[model samples]
Target: MTFSIIGRCQESGQLGIAISSSSIAVGARCPWVRAGVGAVATQNVTLPALGPQILDLLETKQFDPQSALDHALGANDYSEYRQVTVIDTNGRTAFFSGKEALGIYTAVAGEQCVAAGNMLAGTHVIEAMVPAFQNTQGSLADRLLAAMHAAMTAGGEAGPVHSAALKIAGDPIWPIVDLRVDWADDDPIGQLDSLWQAYRPQMQDYVTRALNPTAAPSYGVPGNE
Candidate 1:
């Protein structure tokens, strides 16, 4: 029901995740990232807690991606029904697709990224995502969006995906980019891409507003008017 990629940018040291699913609001549940730590995607039966659990292990406990995934999955009784992937700060990766994952589920790991999907048209859907992320240029968000497009080109979800999300964590305590189309009748990926484009130019303004409101530029909103 969902396909996603968790990746790290080697040049900028950013961690991000891009995901889409037949289900509504996949972003709220499946993807998690912590700056200077790692990223995690928990799908299939969808244990939302697993995403944070993995990140916490990586951030606080000093566990690598593989060990974090193993410890998290090992503690779950329903492990057989879950699918997850993790990428650490060092670009080390690990993944698991349980025995009970839905039709045509598979996972692929590339240089600094991992793509995984369940109830997909075919394994190639995930396969295409790896190179797309690896070869694409520009921001981590751009590469992630490219990977999502590649997945769709190969044969997206088994059914229409209503929701898509892009999340990136850079040097800040907060995410640099977090956009989502919670539910869309048409193309969620395109909608998400549009949101990124609109947000990109002002991405720094948002952080400026947070850290130094006096120094941030005015958006000329209703209150400012």
Candidate 2:
């Protein structure tokens, strides 16, 4: 009942993922990423545990994207009901879409990116995202956001979006930008874009402070000065 996209941008050495689903609070169900590890998007009978489970495998330092995905899928009996996409720090890509997954859903991968979605109008939704990421230039988060926009432009999921989110992390524990619209009007994708633009400055400002705390004093008063 939904169409969504998940991807990572390699240019910034940062990882970002965006998702939009027809179901209410889609962001809460899909999309996950970590710096230096990997990203996972599990949807269509979504299993939230896969988020951390995949991360844990990556943390072991023994598994790559393909191995990690295989192991994880193998452990679950309902694996056929879920769809997943993984992109590791080295840019290795992997994806699994269950046989029972909604029609029109598809996944595609490349050297620096992986795109996947279910309940879409057709395969083009995912096809447009890969090239868009390849040709786009900017921060990982920016490119990821663009990919989601492209998916929507290509006739998005077969249903309306109720929730959307974008997540990216690097060195820092917190995501560079983690924004989710749980429920919205008819145009959740556009709403997510507007919200991301509004929050980008603040998020960037936060990262600037995190990476260089000393620089904070220059942007504001010292000791209430």
- Highest TM-score: which candidate? 1
Q: Residue 206 error for model 1, in Å?
A: 0.6
TM-score, prediction 1: 0.97
| Residue-by-residue lDDT tens digits, candidate 1, 1-225 | 999999999999999999999999998999999999999999998999998889989988568888899999998789999999999998999999999999999999999999999999999999999999999999999999999999999989889999999999998998989999999999999999999999999998888888888898988788751
Q: Which prediction has the highest lDDT against the true structure? A: 1
Q: Which pairs of residues collide in candidate 1?
A: none
The whole-model lDDT of each prediction reads 0.94, 0.78
**Candidate 1: segments with Cα more than 4 A from true spot:** 223-225
lDDT of 2 by residue, 116-164 (tens): 8888888898889887777778777677778888888888888777778
Under the 3 Å rule for N, CA and C atoms, how many clashes does model 2 have? 0
- lDDT score, candidate 2: 0.78
Q: What is the TM-score of each candidate against the true structure?
A: 0.97, 0.89
